[model samples]
Target: MSEIMENPKGGCVLAGINSVLSAIHRTCPVYHSGPGCCMQTTAADQGQSGHKHSCFVSGVSIPSSNMLEKEVVFGGVNKLRTTIQGAVDIIDADAYFVLTGCTAGIIGDDIVSVTNEFKTKGVPVYAIETPGFAGDSSLGYEAIWNTFIDQVIEPSEEKDDKLVNIFGIVPYHDPFWSGTLEEIDRILSKLGLKVNTFFTKKQGIETIKNSSKAALNIIINPWLFKGPAKKFENKFNVPSIRFPGLFIGATDTSEFVREVGKALNLDSELVEKVIREEEEYVYNYLAQAIGVVSWKRFAVVADANNAVAFTRYLANDYSFTPVLVIISEPIYRQEDKERIIKRIENLEYANPPKILFLSDQYEINEAIRNEEKEITLLVGSSNDREVALEKDIQFINGAFPVNERLIFNRTYAGYKGSLTFTEDIYDNL
Candidate 1:
């Protein structure tokens, strides 16, 4: 028997796909699903993420076929085509993506064929054939990237050595994705590199279309975009470097910078100078705020990427004891879990926190409650807030499903972002 997950973080696959497509500037997603699929998917991801919604098209503003019982019984292909045409005519987007809901997928609707009809007319329409039930939001992220690799990116002889495309950071789903991408872009720009964080900086389909010209692809997650990265390299001839986790605090961020520099064979003098300046900038702020926030044994409940980053940052940089670290996402691969565990375990100052792979809210809460190690501060999503309250521990809203605060370009990553994160810790205390 399949067990029910209570308050599972993020939405279905369709929700993930919608989140990614909606994040791209001037890119619209046309849903060919049931009546409420659009709204439910929007609520599942965007609604729970720091109260930030897409300004261009999202939530109720998105175009949908709204497949009904009649359409499901017969076929939604005609309706889907009409929806795509309507979105193209009215949405003013650089590209239109047709996403299949469970209903459409179950009924075996030919969404790809319908989308191809528009494509033949030179319309920027693509079909993502993955259904909502295929997997969770993480799969949605990969599916969209795979679609881009297969359909959008073109081969180019001209390549920019200083150009790089970023992957693994899911838009809206990650809550602080925009700010994190912006921080990464700012840091890379200091090294005289052009960064393509497609979800930010008004980058749309054109950027994706020309992404093959990038010299390298940087994936910042422990285990994501594996298939797409290989496909991207094979098709575009652009190699990629994978950073194990999101870089937070000075040490990891500097390490990330140096790694990128080495990969690109950038000027060593320039790279060192940038790193030195950035470290100084972070330390200068940290020096003043010394002892402003007392360190305590903390626990983090977040996705694999954030779990690793937060665990390492708190343990190694801030010199806090991590008592428990729960990866709140369902990681299927044992290798991926091992990689994440290794990163979390190999901290500098503190003992490795007890790591658990958990997704259900009940199980997550129970694990935290039953932890033998004393946790004074909890850094987690809003879902974990009540547990923190029950434990009477200080809580920092750092992860996804962040409904407590409105986050706009506020991040806890990189040199500058680490300072902001410190301020948040202090403020909460």
Candidate 2:
């Protein structure tokens, strides 16, 4: 008997290309697959991030071989070679990377050889065989790092003691990625530490090349990257800290800055001073929004990371109750699922939420309509707006595939992010 699939989240691999492509400005992702994959990546990115951070060749404008039946049966090497060469010649790009899909990856094309040819021509090329069938979009994220570590990054002789690199964020995958990174970057800068958020305006492709120079790599989440971190440590002799999640609220943000201070063995007096000033700034705006957060019940639909992070911020900072949480982060491994459950279970809540690991839109919509307790507020992707409307509750966009507002480096992280988040949600209500 065929096994029944319960609420299958439509799998994608092209999203990986967008993650890497968006990191650097003017970086052309020469898609080595058919036209459909390129179009899908372009369409998805345009719909979400096009308002502010959309790059030179994100969606349909991306260069592609657009493989056909004949190329599928025989090979797409010649077409790809032509495409890359033409792109390098025509497109004024800082870097050129290629991602392959099921068709080209299945055919076992010698992609490395082709990319190396352009590399020999001093074209700044990198390529990885990231097929949708290989894994989810997350794996494509891994591919980008792996290609950079193996191909782009060079050995560093000198390491900066105060320099740290931030890892674990999947750009474009998270709706507020740019703002979040910048927030953390700003906080770290305050502490007299240089930060490299791999995908930033000043530190995009350059981060890949200079990654070896950092003394520490701060992984923003537990479930992000290990292989790349390991490789980085092995090469540069840098230590790393695995922060549970992005520091969203005041207490959490203070704790993160303090912990990072401790990790780097910086002066306690200095760290405390910074935290005090930042917290004061955070709560100054927070005081005005107390009435908004007071006596409110909420439900959130988000990926596992946001579900946990936002829940902590809501409960700890403003006393908003999370009645139900829909964690949409894909759980392929039993351990990942259990980890999320344990994390949510351990969270301190006045009225804990009934958490569901769901991807089905129908199920998620139903979960929000609670007869037991009315959800006064919602924090999640744009899809949850309909449910919020049906329930006549206020909705706050905090996750991926967002619309109705543009996320241009606005964050719900650190002291500034806490204030920004508070004003954002409070103003909406």
Candidate 3:
């Protein structure tokens, strides 16, 4: 927190719109901020959503108020109203959301009022307040749900036992979010369960509208969607189960599927049958990979969710040694911090103290420096690229600020995800 370093992972709160835009299907983000603010500040971090620069929603091409000095002094409400109305006319959006940035937040613009004014125009308009000054990207990520809870959500009373809703895989922030979501969908599909991940290519406005109709909700992490999940449960009378992370590797994923099965009152025999089929393919793939992956040692420098799941998978399944596990997000909640720590300590060669929480890039690099030779692989963000390069280690990006690869529906969770992880690491090797 004290020392600064270059190109650290993550971004400000306003960048949360990137995830919102990416996951909300055909939804558009109408910025209540100044011109080019969304693109200039957050596009690179937005990385690549399949819908990039589209009129619907991407890191670029957001319909912004473009408030100039004239509007700033006189209040930008008129401009925001005009922009919202213009976006409704222009963009082919299933739903529209209004988000504010630093300028609008500081000037105290009534974005909510403007968005609500268009309510009866045969479209849904949601509003979220995201000032860069409010907090970091993680908080911004959680704020998406809060905005949903506070602003404009029409509760769905319809129930569909065959459908489920997934949360906590933040788009853009988690590079493989769309892919991971797709993989999860695939797994659930085999169980006769349809999932709505909101932002992935397959889902759209219908997913958002019918989210409350699902019999159950699955939040991938406890940290990000706690508020939204709870509010949703109360509002829609739907129950939820909180998974540790993206069901990375067999052990966790098997439990994830079974848990879903139990929640849905699915037949145990069918659930076990699905797990057996998935594991058979996974182990068969690993059979030929044993020689290559057997002795590899790795260091994980990722957010809390990836940090815990990646460490568990490497040590338990691949027999890879995890020399260091650095979680880049500061622990704000005791329960979340405790859960992550427990997950790490429960690893095969678990060292609780080695599971550190540090966001400063300088500190992360410094910690990585000491174990340079021992750690043969770096599973982290672009920030750790310099460390991996200097140490001559095999590196793979599994977190934010990734520029090396374009990730879309490429997952690292469940059986298929494990295979993709193997393929990527092997390719890197």
Candidate 4:
């Protein structure tokens, strides 16, 4: 199968093309750090929003890289003013986001105060303390969403329509995401309601501020978007439903659609039509690509929810017995924990995959050495891909490189994504 080989850890946090396009399209209450951080500017020259900071955002400009050592040492309150003011003067952003990098975090600079200072100017500014050392881009996404909800969004007394907010999508150019959004849009449309896919693709600031108007929220990945989902529920009384990545031809979509449908009291006929059509399209596609194999042995190493969903689906649908399952990122949310545990308990064989809670390369190597079964599928990062290659094993890099254009970036999200997934791994088969 198609496997990722190498990846650089830091750059612009949101690197996916689709993810960036989503952010630009929405013109949402979002900003990127300088090209230094994960928010690299790559918008085509179409309009002001598509220019630099406001380049893709029409009338918004993210802060510049003018905050120097003196300002960093004395605390960047004044320097922040210069940057924010300059951006404000140039871009007509609804609000400003003061994001932190590794240096800002190490210095313990008061981003909150800097944000308050900007707010004193009667401009809406929020502080997002996403240090590079702290976590990945997913964490940064959560920080951005949370800061927006907690600091900028005003609690409205009037209840609006029954729309649902779909938060936490970072529209990186993973081809799978396009199809995933299309499938989700179709399902939501069948419910006679529209969704606000903020900051992922075609999402913007107005869409984010109007989150209070949404009746419910659907979080695709809590790891990346937990900040916004929690804020919407706590402040607006909107319940949130979380899910792992939505892979193509996933039999589990039916249950997901059913749960959301129940909440909306949507037309069952339409829901059934969408679900049936999507599922069949995927099932038929997979049937042709995936054939019976002598070794059903598989292994999954991914983020918590992704690992749980993939391993369970592989077992439930493809009859691939996962003998080794490694959840690289530990389960943080209770719901995710429960979901993983439920799948583990339901495993047909009591001798489930050798489970390991891994944090880095050392842990993964140690786990591999202790494996009792010959691994047929290694699903995780390019690091694991290397390890598998060393052992002359077949592998698929589930998540590694943040950039897709660099490496024929393929994803496993949604039904159409599954077909691409099968194609990527076909050479190995």
lDDT per model, in order?
0.92, 0.76, 0.77, 0.57
**In model 4, where is the ten-residue run with the lowest total lDDT?**
43-52
Q: Please give the distance, in angstroms, between residue 390's alpha carbon in candidate 4 and its true position after superposition.
A: 0.8
Clash count list over all predictions: 0, 2, 5, 39
Which has the greatest TM-score?
1
Per-residue lDDT of 206 in model 3: 66
Against the true structure, candidate 4 reaches a TM-score of 0.77
What is the lDDT, from 0 to 100, of the residue 401 in candidate 1?
Answer: 87
By lDDT, the better pick of 2 and 4 is 2
Q: How does candidate 4 score on lDDT?
A: 0.57
In model 3, where do residues sit more than 4 Å from their true spots? 1-6, 48-55, 349-353
**Candidate 2 residue spans exceeding 4 A from truth:** 1-11, 348-351
Tens-place lDDT per residue, model 1, 47-107, is 9999999888888888999999889788988888778888888888888888889998898
Model 3 TM-score (2 dp): 0.92
Candidate No. with top lDDT: 1
lDDT of 1: 0.92
Off by over 4 Å in 4: 1-69, 90-94, 102-124, 129-136, 157-162, 168-179, 222-230, 244-248, 287-295, 330-338, 344-351, 402-411
Candidate 3 yields a Cα-based lDDT of: 0.77
- Model 2, range 217-240, lDDT digits (tens) per residue? 898764667677788778668788
- Against the hidden reference, what TM-scores do the models get? 0.98, 0.92, 0.92, 0.77
Q: Model 4, range 245-333, lDDT digits (tens) per residue?
A: 44334666676777778777777887788788878888887777558444457787666545665676667666777888776653457
User: RMSD for each model, in Å, please?
Assistant: 1.0, 2.5, 2.5, 6.4
lDDT of 2: 0.76
* lDDT-better candidate, 1 vs 3: 1
